[model samples]
Target: MAYKPLAHIPTHLISGILGVGKSSALLALIQQQPPEEVWAVLINEFAPAGMDALLLQDQVPQDAKVTFAEVAGGCACCLANLPFKVALNRLLRQTRPDRVLIEATGLSHTRELKHLLTGPEYAQVLDLQSVMTLVDARQLTQYAQHPLWIGQVQAADCLVANKTDVYQAEDYQNLQAWQMRAGLADKPCYLVSQGRVHLQWLMQPAVQEANKAPTPLFSPIISASSSSAYQAASITSTVRLTLSREQLAASWQTWYQQQQKTWGTHIRVKARLSNMQACYHLQAVGAEYQLDVLPLEKSSPLSSMQRIEVIAVAAKEDIQNALTLWAQELGILDEA
Candidate 1:
């Protein structure tokens, strides 16, 4: 089928870990696009704070006009199907945006999310633009080096490497090697820090100008999963807490490191803090020693509590244990 960027409303998937700077890049793009061009934003998270939603609202440049919706509970790729529908349905009803930007949770499986958008249900309503996955420069060094990172990096139409500020002393040669191994073709890899993205590259149309453009390949987890299969493996677990600002800040990095060490790459994490000082933080672990996080924002509805959502690839029993351990650490697993 011939895809037209204008024939259908184009939406982007800004995905990475909790700290890589997806929100930063989104802000940069929104800042560059004329207000009339921006349509709406779909912000998904694993947490409830919705801080990123608010920050993006404030950063949408005075001259820009855009609307936003927030989806939290889990990765929109997995748990938040209804929320996705509710958010998009409402946005579609109220605002007909030229473009839509979906800020996905860090742990979100971009391939899966793309499939959902391209599925028959939403195919007519939305056009799947490029799947943009943000990579933390530091973590990309580690993630792209992992055996399974190819599946993640190669799936992206554009692999944005955020946190360039942290890579000044690092070697890009390693990254080049990793990119080659990931079979990235001529796909663009951008280095951005403090949320600086190349607006021209991002805002350009995502549809193939012609049939000769290479077709992006999706992972089996996404392409092969039937609706029943998706329902069978999907588990939505929530963690709520009432920590003071100090405690919340302390738990952020500490909890991540702890989960990284304990889970050993089987868990995915996302959070939105109420402080509004930080963008949503998220972490995703796949195979052994593969972990990364980046900051992200989109927009969704308001929430009354602070929560985090987790998703993993495991049996129900294993997922239950993992969720329990995670909740135990936060001291709120029993609340629900």
Candidate 2:
């Protein structure tokens, strides 16, 4: 059956695990939007720096046609999903865009978000075209990474295997098994790289994309009460750190690992810090983190002051507090 395009404004929700290329795909999709129509992108992140907002703003021209607002502090569904609605409604009311696109926090439960979108309150306002999930082919190569990605599979209206430029034989085999589990291979699943999804393809509403009924999106509180489960948080500190970029990178990784050993996996963390070498970007998922030198070259010279933003799942405040204490222990606590 041919998918029908709605006459109303289309709102797209792009979801994926952290570092899986949702923003990259979204940037590609937004660039294709009509130049004359006003398009609003409401981005949520767990960091105050709001890296996605910076990345998206950098790609899109600074014009009236494209407007952006950011929701930071934590994932959208946390805190009773209030902050998400407040920020989203504010963006929508203020922008009244011809189109609305929401890039949810990487750790957000897409099912929870979808429930909100289709619920009576928003159904009238949001012409939800689809929920697109982007996956990294490299991550699919691992057997253990499967559980981490299942939520994305269940909630997406389209499944895009991105970064195929790095695919190996094992990755393809793993993907086959994954797709079979998802029942999305014969649906609208696709393989692409560098976030090149066409905007038109995602807007198709009538296409039957998945073989199974929609999977449960949340487990009553996103497993909030489970002692074994993870909870998400944002940790920000502005302080003086004298370490070099390489040193900072190493330290961040070590800290993440030590915490993971004590608590659980650190889902993702993005930090911008100014050190003697330069102000650099630190990106981490699990325990691995890297310092990108290119952003440094374009960045301003380092000052004694560095503002750090961290987003991770450490389960309730007990772990979150410990992570905060760890950041302070690094002697980077900034009072300002």
Candidate 3:
């Protein structure tokens, strides 16, 4: 048997609204990848302070060869084309990685970026892995009325309707309506919480036959499971907990069930475990579950860190309360 050669660097373009958890999702992905694999992350933040770039750098594996690029001052999709090209060129020239993750600012144009990556010049360097859009469930009503929103939805290779943890029963009804409005009923858009995504789905290739057909609301290539659950959009809260090697797996199962119940429609729970030998991970996007445990360096600091970074995607009050509750369950860190 023979297989088509995979791209040298599987780059993902993550685009979404300003507060829709794009940065958080990028952080989670960085946490999951092995350090020795060599990955380059390019973040183009719209804000002037470069805060998102700083946060992403902090999450990188210390020993991993990582290059952080910041295109600040304006929307990368509009005013930063040269900067975007420079960043890509620099990453390819300096630290050649197996994959690159581009976290696009809310106002950036997905189609433009796709054009740039798929253009003849870039084809020799970067592989366009996928264009993923993050949608706000609570804003579905508004999104349905906006032309730009429809454009964004149409351009995505994968659509993640995030913050499902806060969506009401009526919201899904509205979501179905919204889905119909966008003419994306056939596209494969998963209602994921806390940016929880299946690495397997990310790694898999797009279905060539379906890719040639009319627009689809979801990817036909996605593997289905009896346990997978899909939800409407809503708020979401995430808490990362560090556990002992002996206590880790069992503790996660208990927490996951409690999370699905307590946050119910208001949460999406994801976990990453880094012990001495490897990093074991699990993500429940609605009812779907995926597990992967990859080997790590013996002397890596991952084991000692034993840290989980939880993010709440709804309101400030909800975030504070969720953080408080999690701190009690997972123990808060003392001030340095």
Model 2 / residue 37 / CA error / Å? 3.6
Candidate with top lDDT is 2
Off by over 4 Å in 3: 1-8, 145-147, 204-336
Top-TM-score structure, candidate number: 2
Q: Which residue pairs clash within candidate 2?
A: 238-334
lDDT of 3 by residue, 1-336 (tens): 233233456777888755566866777677777755667788876544344554444345566566678775456666748887887778766766778888886656666676677767777666776577788776664333333344456667777878788789887787777677667687667777877765444554322221122233433222222111222121112332355544656655566566566554334444444544555554443444444555554323433333332222334355445544554554433333
Q: Which parts of model 2 have CA positions greater than 4 angstroms off?
A: 1-7, 31-34, 46-51, 54-65, 72-81, 137-151, 194-196, 206-228, 237-244, 260-266, 275-279, 293-331
Q: Write the per-residue lDDT of candidate 2 for residues 52-138, one digit (tens) a residue.
A: 665455345555487778887666777588888888888777767788888987767677777777667777777787688887756
TM-score of each: 0.60, 0.72, 0.58
Considering TM-score, where higher is better, how would the candidates rank from best to worst? Answer: 2, 1, 3
lDDT of 3 at 144: 38
Off by over 4 Å in 1: 1-7, 61-64, 144-150, 168-170, 203-336
Write candidate 1's Cα lDDT for 1-336 as tens digits. Answer: 333343467767777754456777777777766644647888886554354565566445444577778886567756747787788778876666778888886656666666677778877777777777777645543443232233345556787776666575554665676567557647888866677876556554443322122233322333222212110112222334455445655665565566556544445554443333323333333432211222223323332223454444345455456555655665554354
Query: Each model's C-alpha lDDT?
Result: 0.56, 0.66, 0.57
74 Cα displacement, candidate 3 (Å): 1.8
